[model samples]
Target: MGRNVKSRIESESQKNNLSLIIIILLALQVILSGVVLLRIVNLEKLIGGTEASEPVPVYVEGVSEGDNPALGPEEAPITIIAFSDFQCPYCASANQLIKEIMQEYPNQIRYVHRDFPLKEIHPDAFNAALAARCAGEQGQYWEMHDALFSNQEDLSIEKLNKQAEILNLEMDQFNNCLTTRKYENKILIDLQAGKEYGVNGTPTIFVNGYHVNGADREAIINIIKDVL
Candidate 1:
């Protein structure tokens, strides 16, 4: 009778041990799942990066070009031609700073925007520029430009359309403009110009028509000061 009782107790203890093992396994699984989920969330945010509403760099002959358009009088003093990419992070920052510079100089400084979409790295750069040109067709270039740079992330047709809508552009005109690639040649022309000027990377700038190879804000300011 005593042997039977001891054997029963041992069986119960084994059952208890099995239960504890199962519980531990389940807890470990839950912990692993939580860690994986958190990591995935962080990875996604890191990958998405940023977006754009409008991009200034022009694609000339498939090369990025400065959008200085027409040069001012040789005696116009301070001229800043900023070559930028719609998808470049540094260019984006530079552009924001450029706005302040523009404001500071106001009438005295002339700042031109050049387009050099590094589509290889920035897949959406071309699309963003395309959207800007579409907006320009409806006389909303600057409006779209501000919107693109402001939104800088989430650069998609839907977002571009929203920007156009906000600027009160004719959707049909904008859509048609984008579809027909109305400004494709214009962008290509800008790219060719960049080639002529030996612009390999962006945000290569030209201050007073001189290439500011490494275009940092201070460099630009100093050049402007010299020209001024």
Candidate 2:
């Protein structure tokens, strides 16, 4: 009877050990599955980014006009319609880069500047854009454009007003335009246009209807040169 009892205890111990091993194996499988799922999600994001970086052709429908602030000749063979956010660092860099490109192909490119401010990220951006538009009313659009970019670090209402003052813009008129949101509708129209053109982010340049996203200076220059 003692020997039989001891053998039964040993069998039960073996069963408990087997159960613990199975539980551990199941937990490991779950952890491995989670890791694989996370890796797949990260890989998908990388693939999406890779696909986005490639340039796509966009059907841009609009005539280059004088109503908006523009540089270079309206009749130039290459038309560059740029959708930009003022407070964006990349946009600021692209602003300067575009200016250089204009200088390089002065007679060949008609550059149209449109406002596409990402107000969610840059709260002061819409106001800064309005400041530029108001300055345009005073015949100093480019002046204010340069000023805002130069002082991107300090784009408070006071700094914008200071920029206006520096540009010699009529304070009363500028203030009224900003206060009343005079160009708000126009800015909205530009944003809608950007959306129509599939502009997911700033510094989206349409070089004769070829869409180039981001601050790709070389790609922009090459596209213009190809058209020229």
Candidate 3:
């Protein structure tokens, strides 16, 4: 009847409408769970190496470098230092290419993988990295890393442990390393290095001392040519 009452009524109506909409969306989400899962599956296929169109920024690192220097040959003529997330699609694509390069060079090129798991977006990525680190302690880092990338669609802890088991790592040790935050400091250090490398996204790579400017990796090959 009065202005205050009208305002209160409107506010109450608004609250009720918002609540109703939220409930409806929640129902829709429930109904579309299968569709969501299907979409996640489809997106996984397009995850890495799908779009080679985005022009990436040319990166530079004055003091920042790759995370694991010990993973490759000490005398490698070319070093590809990369900061990547376990769950990122492009990271997976870069990894697939790097695998090919490794087989191609055998010993000439060193590929260093750094843990840059983006927790907010990909919660399972950090755990995957940690699990891989655990496997690394057992001389199976590459095994775990490959498994993670190969099965990027399922980066769950259950899946990570399954991968660890396949790598022959002791289950207890793997779980402990993941839950105890064993590689927390190392991950942080790698993130700092990523920052120094001027990385603002996953799959940021540097050849020698310069950043590969594009996601497609043609720029990476060019850098390698000049250095080699």
- Candidates in order have lDDT scores of 0.72, 0.84, 0.79
Q: Local error of candidate 3 at 14, Å?
A: 86
* Model 1: residue 28 alpha-carbon error in angstroms: 75
RMSD of 1: 15.2
TM-score of every candidate relative to the true structure: 0.65, 0.72, 0.70
**What lDDT score is found at residue 141 in candidate 2?**
92
Span of 10 residues, lowest total lDDT, candidate 2: 57-66
Give the candidate number with the greatest TM-score: 2
Give the residue spans of candidate 1 off by over 4 A: 1-76
lDDT of 2 by residue, 1-228 (tens): 999999999999999999999999999999999999999999999999998775655556652332578878868998777788888888888888888888887688887888889989989999999989999999999889888887788899899998888877889999999889899888888888778778878878788877776767777777777776
Report the error of model 1 at residue 8, Å.
Answer: 99
As for lDDT, the candidate ahead, 2 or 3, is 2
Compose the digit string of candidate 1's lDDT tens values, residues 101-197.
7787766766667677777887877778888877866666766776777787777778887888888898898888877777777677777787687
Candidate 3 lDDT score relative to the true structure:
0.79
How many clashing residue pairs are found in candidate 1? 22
Comparing 1 and 3 on TM-score, the stronger one: 3
